[model samples]
Target: MNSYSIPRFTMVLAGVLMGCLAMAAPDQPPVSAEKADERAGALLAKMTTEQKLELISGHNQFFIKGFPELGIPQLYMSDATQGVHIRPQLSNQLEKSVAFPAPIALAASWNPDLAYAYAKAVGEECRAGDVAVLLGPGMNIYRVSQCGRNFEYFGEDPYLIARMVERYVRGMQDTGTMATLKHFVANNTDHRRRTSNSIVDERTLHEIYLPGFKAGIDAGALAVMTSYNQVNGEWAGQSRAVITDLLRGQLGFKGLVMSDWTSVWDAEKIIKSGQDLEMPGKANIVKDAARLLAEGKVAMADVDRMARSILRTCIALGLHDRPVKDERFLAKFADHESVALQSAREGVVLLKNNGVLPLAPKGTGKILATGTFMEKLPRGGGSADVLGYNAVLLKQAIAETYGERVTFVAEPTDEQLKAADVVLLSTGTLDKEGADRPFALAKADEARVQRAVSLNPRTVVIVNSGGGIQMTDWNEQAAAVVYGWYPGQVGNRALVEVIAGLTNPSGRLPITIERRFKDSPGYGYVPAGEDVGKGLKRGEEMAKPVYPIEYKEGVFVGYRWYEAKKIAPLYAFGAGLSYTTYAYGQPVIAKANAKRGEAVTVTCTVHNTGKVAGAEVVQLYVRPAKAPVPRPEKELKGFAKIPLAPGEVKTVTFTLNPRDFAYWDVARHDWSVAPGRYQVLVGGASDRIAGEASVTLE
Candidate 1:
């Protein structure tokens, strides 16, 4: 079988801008899955067995094998969640990409539309680089603050992650690029082995870990990369229960499923598990897959299924007819830079403040800035690492903004600290891909911060990282504190603007900023190499029966754990201070009684009772009473970010849906909603609930 064609389905390039290779037009929709499958099956019927085997694996490091004889081009993929990942091998051949703010930073904004805009810019860059598949929108729930790649993921809650990721998937896919939701099912840590088994219960998995992936699938994500870790003693990539049973059957995801790079070792198991592709070029599968099939260990249907999925996605994305990489799109990166700037502006959270901000409108005192990464922009390391083409630095942006009033120093003397009206101490943790990072700032850096605070209680501490860091040590002493989570490229500008009152700080903490890392749910979660397996050799840590990472905290993740344990977080999840103030009115429920599947609407009025205009994130948390099973004390169900002018009052409403009131029922093997009274708390932040209303579900 050879030289097959499916021309009808190939030209459905409706979404993308025809000549510019730009983003999808708002009115023009992308091709349908049924059309893609139909076209793929037509092509698959004509492929030889050898070609079928080749179609399901990588051609090289970052490409899928193309069927040139049949007109399928080799598909290009890239590493990243935030931006077009720049690598020596990958970037050398293309224009430098915009280092969009890390998704964690974007998560801080709690704005779905911003997330969509952020991803659409990334997708445009993806097409500009000829990348057919953008291997992210990595929506793994942030389990631990120490997890190096937490920067690439949405924060702790399943509900928030789900909402953000759905928009992220649509944004990326809308630009004619395939959006991949990754590290499927309990892949949280980037510790030793990257294969530590995640010990999770069925109920916990559904209630906590699975919602984001389900949302992405529902949003029509084109690919899913299986996790490197094992879920219940089985590699997620090669687990039939995880893939075929849960992902495909339960979630009904028919898109392409691929293994993480070097994540699969067992060829027979991977083929049978319904993992459609082996990435970074096939090794284990290509060698022994045919023999396994001949020996009745694997079925030909499995191979056909894998090949068909990859083909369908490629055809559906119009990769066959469209040019994946176009130099024309590179010139438009300037246009995407604004989105990066806006994301940063919206995402840098002001953790604490005491009237020292808005230096522009009020005090015209000297600004003393001290920190490393003053000239060089510091961001997390590894696969998500993106180099700056024209990134601004903290010192540069501050100096550029405040000219002669700013004095910069690396390690300022006590006199310098006391002499200045305000101190900007820039500090953050540099997390990476293959390992966990320290939960606290380095001792010397901590000492510097302490010294600055001691000398001058007017220091405004700015810490950057993917997630929260230990703040109990000096946060109390500091006059003010800001959490700028690895805000990319133009992030420094946003920080300066917030400090200067040009842009009001509205970004909230997506993850809780713990007083101490030890109090965290994921405290000591990443096992050391020695903890992998007793008496196992150094290199053999990757072997099977790997030691499991027990999620001891269960459903009490982030703010839930803090509230449940009665531990006061330095700043709670959804905690962010603004230059202005806002007050909330009592929440009003549309109806006291509602059906299980019916919508529950909670409305509240927020008054901007401050001197300036700003955005307020109205968080809605659900607390159920008299439920059958154990539940978190409070779970974030819905939220709205509203911008208001000073002295203006605006009404904000949140609607609860079927999944909002349901919990994973282990006995039923499904989501079950209990008929009971549910409390809805609405406020600006999680800890600052100003209003509550009760709804009785019948």
Candidate 2:
């Protein structure tokens, strides 16, 4: 019997309910699990290979037009991450829902509460549209810039990404909308993504690329989307290591795996590897699988197992429930302005400040606002970029905060710069094409900043961007500078708080900013299409010279790379400052000898001696005093954000597990803790280690 023509939604629902009930059993052995699968497979095995093939090839025509299948209705799938991107034209309008902020902005907030709030609102919007499965919360690593879909990603670090992904998934699931954690495995970039192989080693793949998805899975994400890119050498859609070995075997992901939109390359391979569904297309992997079964090349049990897997996912997401026709989804949709505002405040980093910040006088000094970012705002771009919502620009933020007395000027003239007591110049590149582009702050803008600095000498410039920038030209010229990535609607208000000294900027730079492009780890490893070809220009590339972006500084990424090279950056990672001063006492470890699995605590006293209230991030780093393999000066193990008023003294403590200090020993295929004395440094950023203590792991 054809797998495509199997009892459709009716039997799928029955299978799902049975599977759920069976899953409740605790003492189930592997043989029992396989036997249960075989039993489920038996039902599918009775159908003709052609019938089974039809069910797999096309969904019901009611939901997906043109794919007719025995009068059965297709399951309604919708697009949603923060919210649904419904087709703008109503005729093709599949969903009508309230959209939320992109994930990248959410990651900056570092607040799970905001992530849940945003997701709940999006889920409400989804429910109204009768969308059963939401296609997103795209959690691919921001490996490179050419990935046209980076706006959907969270950030660079694995821990930060994990936090955001878990919250987002929980939010969507809470609203009864199935959240799909997507682009499974190492599907990092979009350049040649469908076929390009991500040649990442095992350690990088496990630690960095897979953790967020692991977190989402543990949080009960219903589905996973296999990416277009290949991992190691096999396509993620078909790679057993990615789909079976890692996602299912290691992470224990019980959810169904689906392909990206038309991302399927091999039907039988994907089906065998455990990809449950091929998205938005009628390419029949199930039918092909059924044929293989009838031909005796593959067992009928295999086809049954695949069908049962798809049925289980549909059941788990509760897709079997019939839709109720109503517009009630609108009421569930919330604007969620508070969450957006909170994210912006926490996301903005105070990179450089000298006594000039927190504006000495209220409603003070003629602030000459200059920079293109003020007028032509820089928004997170690409497939996930939202066009209709309200946003707060720096100019608007300053004006609202300082009131009518503030003077606003765009692209300030040299004379205008001299007349101002304090100049606020908003500068930085608008990140597009996934990562930072070739032009890091145009020379013209740099000259404008140079001229402004020469005139006022009290100029304060703010960098607006998602990633880092080349600050070599303007760092010396500016009195203070802030890094504000694409802050959402309440960005203006947050900036005002930091400026007024009401909210001390405590955001750590998620990624490092190099003084020049030459300083980046993957500076030379860029794809041929991304290369400017030394003034050859965009869209005029010649095939002859394949200038691969040289990744000379391998594994020395972020501050670790720059620190090891002793190359100074304009600002370091975990770098932020406040109006008040913080003094750190000598660090002391809680235990002298700690075991591998146990956590070691470090304590330090921080005193706010200055006359202003401020917030500080007490970063804890651990370095092996002696080790065989090379290591950075230190690796960030843990951190705590503490707020203190003037004259306030508080003890900030950070706890670390031995695994935090361990490195992946690929040779042993396990995380190894080198037996040695380790130094614990507690301070601000990587460069400012103020307090130190030593501990031993036994």
Candidate 3:
């Protein structure tokens, strides 16, 4: 982050009078809904039925069909959960891109403003590729620790995920590039994702799962991509209950709804379900839709709706009028890399520190770098693996930071371990799309880590993972522990800076790290699978569940389950330490009593009590002192990130709405707040509460 500087105002009043005027005049304001519909309608009228059908499907693997004769530009799309996964050019050369930290990493930062900056940079990358729609900002709630796709999403809390998703959607669309909120609803685990059915209750769906999607839609996301799995016995892409009723009706999303590649089953059902687009250009959609319409299996009105959805989005976003491709941003990616570096700096969680971090400046001693990802920039496999341009590996960063003092060793002997001043064990396993990562590190990694920890207590272990991993094996013996989630491209530089004391670690754990995998709510819930459907895509398809994978834990995911069941985890949600310390003063409630639909304000003062300047993430947890129904101990309602110099204190204020205190009423089919006493807890993490106050809600 220090390597890049923020752009300053250019005293543009001198030149911007002409430049700004030119820009302001040429670019028309965003068309209203009525205007967008009229424009789309005019274009739709010019196209034939075949052309309309083509508009609803992809032309190439990542492009939408466009008519050059009609002056429409073919729009490209890309997989962009982490960064722009730039497609290969016609020459088959991969396009270079700046890789930002994973979504979970950004979520860990707990800075919505940073989330906006992180996403805006990525949106710029989308423009560089001329990608009209970015198949990203996947906000599915993290359900299991072993979920492979967790890195692509925010953590397990609905409120936290919603806040991040809202910012990300706004940031991407604000760049004039469309953002797609993806894997709509309950896409927790990637294992058997194509076939597994997530059996979630209505209340759990609304309370724990739907908030993130709703936030994205409310933020003006232009598109949504359907999940590959089934929900309540029907494929999510072809479920009217999920698409038409839940997404469009309840969430009020009127965007283009596209299915995951090869995810659609019955064309007739998809047409009726409001799946506006089938991706990767499937032939069955065109061929079967003709017959379905002729046989009255599908309505012409629904088909028109689907095609109109695509056209409306294109017209509304001005994608139909402008060239989708622009290489201008590629030259400016150094600025984006700095954003990635800043995200990594803010997201690296100092899990444990026994005065071993920020090791004695220049006298830190011979740094021993070892791990599976020592030489490679670890990333989630599949689409999230954006080949980072100028990505710094852990070893590379360590060497760059420490110079001649750094040494590379896969396995150090007892003598070597004893000889080194510090053992920097940079360890993590690569995550794949369809496979679930183990809750524990690999046996070989465990042994090496344990050996290093046992021999050299100065061992500073850096773990790169999507979520929690088995740390109990040797974490206690290690002098310090850091959870550096997939830091993108130049993100390793930030990690090194934190270790070098140049940057104070401020990230909090987005998800809880359980002491044991079995201690999780989803433990022993692995579905046994068999391929029942013919022509299932790949060999991995055999893992598809024949029976529904029940979410018996319901709304109690992550810290909620731990707090509710009284099972202690290795680390709590929102848990992370910093080089400096912070003290939270007693919270002041603006009002002792509150009614429905009113905002209640809470303020707390925080002081940087330590010697170093650092940032503190002030967390606000809302709890019902007495409730009529079952709920978790506390839920995250509001939060703020405050930076202070040593001895400096700042007061942070948070506003709470009725929805933050309400729970989904299953019987009433609406959110309801039972009249009760509520406690407001403010602190750094869920378990690290420092101050509390009470409020009455009637």
Candidate 4:
């Protein structure tokens, strides 16, 4: 049958079905999941097979069709992580929106409350713009610094990423917008993303790749978007093991699972694997599914399941009861800009500092700012990019703060640098969605920094990038180095404020800054030739074959590998410098001995010994006294960011359960905590521990 005749036949079938389900159910206000399920089931009973098929597929690039005959409205979604993406088509409706700092910068803040507020602002904009679903808070782990989409995700540590992601989900969902936890499972690489398979073990997948999604699920996220990559040997969109077994059965996610734009390999397989929707409906996924159904390859029950899930999500989000109109929501939240500024302020990590920092605004002489990034801020590319609403450039911000004192120069001569009291060198690396970035600075940028530092002793370099960059060439010569990870719209304002001593830098390094690219675990593992099952076999004459990105490092990613291998990085994980000084006290455990599954409270006192008020992130690392299997020297377990006034002390406490110290045991097929003496270290950074305490688990 042609597409035109199919819709007419389904309309008649839908009328008959609606009559059968005409018995009205009790109405409930403030829609709950129970009510949503009931409403969804009623709607499902009334939808014909053709109508259900259309409802499950995209109506357009960014919308899913709804049954207008049953009073259901089409669901409108927007591509958002940093902020609501303003596409050319959406420019008329959404002229401008707040592009807050990237997710990586938010993660650097190490404050979940701030992450919640950040996402809340984004969600508010979604509502104002009539966008029901905001596809954001991409929780994929930052496995490699080179990954183009790294800026769109949280940091490398799963625990940290999970914590931030949960709050992000809560913040967005609370504002009546459905938050989508995207790029599900082992989507770490952008190179060969569509064809390459991620060969990861079950334990590694559960430990490293799945925690962030699990945290979002526990936080009640209503939507999950599948990744473009393949997990194991099957495409993520068509893998029943990943979609059905892991997400639905193990994690207990009851939300709509949609495919990435045109990412589906087989329409029938996606439906059978529990994937609910196919994006860009132009992919003819619905048409193909219909053909499969006619051939007895796809079941009507599968179609009904898909339609019901979408309805449930819509009703639960209150989308069904509301009017579908362009709200033209003005992105006019000054308060949100304040929140964005605060987030940017907290996320600015001081990698290096001498006495040259906190430049006194009163008598500071000419500040020569040189770099391409000074005038035009360097931001990640692709859909994550948003034309920010009134974004302040670094040069503009510096000039605003220190009128007539800051000079912008693309290339500074030795005479120009020598004449300046201080040289502010701005440099950055750019990464986006389609490709990974080269892990080092360009030769010209390195030359600029080296020349500036040599010409003037008091030179401060500001490095802006998605993740880490090779800073070995000129880091030693600079007086200070600050890592500003893709600061959003008002990031320039925050940057100037931090440099001028208005705000103290408190953000820590979320990922390890390797001294060189070759030192990384994934470095040199790229596919070169044909695979020999165990590994690849390089050959001069061979056909290019699809390669697999093996997770050989397993749980030993980021700091874990560096510590275990004893390869010192340029900057350690959880490493951040504050202008003020902090003193750490010995960790005191509530109980020296505890039985299995019992919670242990660990407390430590942090004193601000410096002259200024500042915040310190108290990090907690755990290591087993003895274990059967080899493990990293330590792993981050808990952390708390404490704001302290000069001469003030605060006792920060953390509770740890069995799971906190547990490892993913492959043999047991579950998390296992070996009972033995465990050392708990507390400090300002991961490698710079100041105090330690031991606990015995019986």
- Each candidate's clash count: 2, 28, 2, 0
Provide the global lDDT of candidate 3 against the true structure.
Answer: 0.82
Q: Residue-wise lDDT of candidate 3 within 71-186, one digit each (tens)?
A: 66777788876788855653322378788999999999998877777787888888887677889998888778888888999998999998888878777777788889989878
Worst 10 residues of 4 by lDDT: 1-10
lDDT of each: 0.81, 0.64, 0.82, 0.81
Q: Which lDDT tens digits does candidate 2 get at residues 248-272?
A: 8878887667777656657667667
TM-score-wise, the better of 2 and 3 is 3
Against the hidden reference, what TM-scores do the models get?
A: 0.93, 0.81, 0.94, 0.92
- Candidate 4 residue lDDT tens string, 651-671: 999999788888889899788
TM-score, prediction 4? 0.92
Estimate the TM-score for candidate 2.
0.81
Runs off by more than 4 Å, candidate 4:
1-30, 324-332, 529-545
Off by over 4 Å in 3: 1-29, 89-94, 528-545
Regions more than 4 Å wrong, model 2: 1-83, 90-102, 112-114, 128-131, 142-151, 283-303, 321-335, 360-364, 433-436, 527-555
